[model samples]
Target: MTTPTPVVFIHGLWLHATSWEPWIDLFQKEGYDASAPGWPGDPDTVEEARANPESIADHGIDAVVDHYASIIKDLPVAPILIGHSFGGMIAQKLLGQNLAAAAVAIDAAQIKGVLPLPLSALRATLPVFKNPANKHRAVSLTAEQFRYAFGNALSAEESDALYERWTIPAPGKPLFEAAAANFNPHSPAKVDTANELRGPLLLMTGGKDHTVPEAVTRATLKQYRHSEAVTDILDFPDRGHSLTIDGRWREVADTALDWLRRQEL
Candidate 1:
């Protein structure tokens, strides 16, 4: 029997790793070995993460990339990477490093070379930037703030429900690192985008996403222009940043699965 391909799902800030549970189950049903591992210092559950926010603070982009790298080393295969938001950024870094079979980055955060900073993107992250001290702390989002950042394309009722179920305090360091990526020559937000031999990558963007705007994703695509590797972009013009966790999440997951199949991974 052929060995099933493994898949790793990475979540972005303010979301517990368990938010990928549905995706894991769906991928397993489709014959993939799927798992969603938390970031460094992340508790196993949302309740625990909420109660111990301090444990989730102070981690930065490089730490997160290393955390996932350790997990990948133990897998039977390099695995396919599917990440959302900041998770998406991590996926690109791993893929660019040739650490995965392929990667699907959904509404990924801005990498080093990405330049457009839409007003909505800044507004969504204002809570962290407003206080410089947040860089060393974990920050939680209010329901209204969550609505603006993640669920603007969703109904107030559904958005609030998602907030209650999956939200958790997130470290602010990665945001600061990405914000200063261009200025910092050693920015951890850097990705190898020029690896011609790296695995294929598909970047997905939501037109209504406030947090990681569509323009940012488009620019992220351009970063790979120097490489001859396969890099593709898909636009969900009607979805928001919550596309991976919201009610229509199946649509996004199915799209990713189809892409993976096309790659014969």
Candidate 2:
């Protein structure tokens, strides 16, 4: 008997790990062992995370990468990673380190070498950057902010419902680390984009995303130009950052499943 492949779903800032529950169930039914593990310092539930924001504060990019790495080390085989936002960035770092079989980065956050920073991206993150102290804090978004950052492609009503259902306070440290990545030679946001031996990577971007715009994803793609390993990108022209969690999330998941099948992973 053969063991089923494992799939790990990593959520980005503001959304609880459970936001990936639907994806996990679907992946499981399709014959893969799937789980969505929360980031370091994350509580077991969204309510707990919200009630104790301090418990989730002050973790940086390195911490997140390490947390996921530790989990991967314990797995029987390296899992295929599907990450959104900062989680996407974490997936890339892990895949580059040869820790995962393959990775699908959806609306991933900017890494060290990505240079294009759109105004909307700035605006989307302003809530965390406005106060320097936020770097050591956990920040929550208002419904309006959530709408702009993750749900621009959805109606306001749908956006607000998503917010209520899955949103949680997110640590601000990763944002500060990514924002200063280029300036820091030892930035934690660095990814081994040049690893010719790394596993396949698929970068998925939302054309209407405000948090991580299309230009950023395009530039991220260019960063992998020197690698011989498979590094592909897919664009959802009408989608926003919420493409992975919104009502139409099935489309994105199916796209990823199709890509993985093509990769034979």
Candidate 3:
């Protein structure tokens, strides 16, 4: 029997790849090889990551994308890509380059063509943007900020628990890089939406997400309407940026799993 295609889960800022463990386990149980790789220099655990936030601080979107692309290149078969937040943006980039068989981007960071820069989005990024020096530093969020950006849909207790387990510092460069990508001639935030080989792309949005809200994800979908590939959007009405790690994470995973099964992958 042929081996199932590998599934790669990319993580966003302020969280390491381990946050995908539940999803990885679910996918593995479904007979797919799954992995969630860290950005270069990521620590082994959240505690270690918090202690050594600077380890992955300097790597930008280009660096992180190249890291995952290299991993996919070494796999035995073309992989399905699933990413959250910045990982979502990275997933789209890989798909555009013909690297993935399919992709699911959840609450993804803005790309070049996305136009709604909501005020909530700006507040969510204040930890990094409030300090110009953060461009070269790793930025960590306070519990309040995390609640606002990621756990807005969860109760206070639930949000606190998640913060203790999954939250960490993130490199500021990628956010800065992607924010200016539309105008930067040398920006690494570009994607070739016209690629016929981009396969199927799905952008998942959260109704309660402050960081990458529905408007942002919808705009991303509109950009891909020009692509020859099949592009779609799925919105979780009661979710937030923490959709993948929250109590109803299984619901999100089930939706993605069902979508993949429909694609016969």
Off by over 4 Å in 1: none
State the lDDT of candidate 1 residue by residue for 108-152, as single tens digits: 999998999999999999999999999999999999999999999
True-structure RMSD, every candidate: 0.6, 0.5, 0.9
Query: How far out, in Å, is residue 106 in model 1?
Result: 0.3
- Candidate 2 pairs with clashing backbones: none
Which 10 residues in a row give candidate 2 its minimum summed lDDT? 1-10
Which of 1 and 2 is the better model by lDDT? 1
Model 2 CA deviation exceeding 4 Å by range = none
lDDT of 2 by residue, 44-137 (tens): 9989999999999999999999999999998999899999999999999999999999999999999999999999999999999999999999
The deviation in Å at residue 33 for candidate 1 is: 0.3
Candidate 1 TM-score, true structure as reference: 0.99
Whole-model lDDT for model 1 versus the true structure? 0.96
